[model samples]
Target: MYERVEEMIQGYIWKDLGVKVIEAVDGEVTLHMPVKTRQTQFHGNVHGGVLATLADMSMAAAVNTLVEEKEFTVTAEIKVNYLRPAAGDFLEAKGKVIKRGRTLSHCQAEVFDDSGKQVCFVVATFYMFKKE
Candidate 1:
């Protein structure tokens, strides 16, 4: 299932941002993005928006694992904290579902640099909906 989701992501905007799922299991996912000048700020640090996107994508993927085949999830709310400047060859975001309810899931994610230093943390809520 994770592999299929990873392939599906390639057709989305995440592919344009160079985001890829490196690991995934029930209720958990890890995504990687190679740092590039195009994704950085004037200071050469990775942009906050990029980090947030990584977090959001990872969390969504984690939530995906808990949803039924006919259901999908959307971000209800997300909060990100930039703990440190992110400057590295690559970035990784690890996400896990903390709680799952009938219609909502609570998730958390952490972004780390290539050196394994934590750069950002995120908490997000996702709402699940069935396909019409």
Candidate 2:
């Protein structure tokens, strides 16, 4: 199941995001992103906005795995808490669904640096739309 999800994420339309779905189990998903200079902010660290984007993407992908169809899920709301600066070889984001409904999902994601330190935490709500 996880391998299939990983394949789906790697083939995502937005290839530049560099999102690599690593594992999924029990509604949890782990994804890796290669950090580049373009992903940094003025402080030479990965931007907070980028981290939030990664969290949202991971949450959406994680929840999508549980859904029956390939519905379009959009981030309705996201609250991110920064724990530390993200300046490392790579960034990892892990997501899990806290609650899943027919059309909405409550999810959470945690971002970490290559050194295995927490960098950010995000809580998000997703709206699943029918495929047109």
Task: Give, for candidate 1, the lowest lDDT window spanning 10 residues.
Answer: 1-10
Model 1 residue 34 distance off true place after TM-score fit, in angstroms: 0.5
**CA lDDT, every model vs. true structure:** 0.89, 0.83
- Model 2 is weakest, by summed lDDT over 10 consecutive residues, at 5-14
Query: Model 1, clash count?
Result: 0
Clashes of each: 0, 0
For residues 7-117, what per-residue lDDT tens digits would candidate 1 score against the true structure? 558666687878878988999998898988999999889999989988998998888877776778899999999999999899999999999988989999999999999
* Per-model TM against the reference: 0.93, 0.86
Q: State the local distance difference test value for candidate 2.
A: 0.83
lDDT of model 1 at position 110: 100
**Clashing pairs in model 2, backbone N/Cα/C closer than 3 A:** none
Model 1: per-residue Cα lDDT at residue 66 = 70
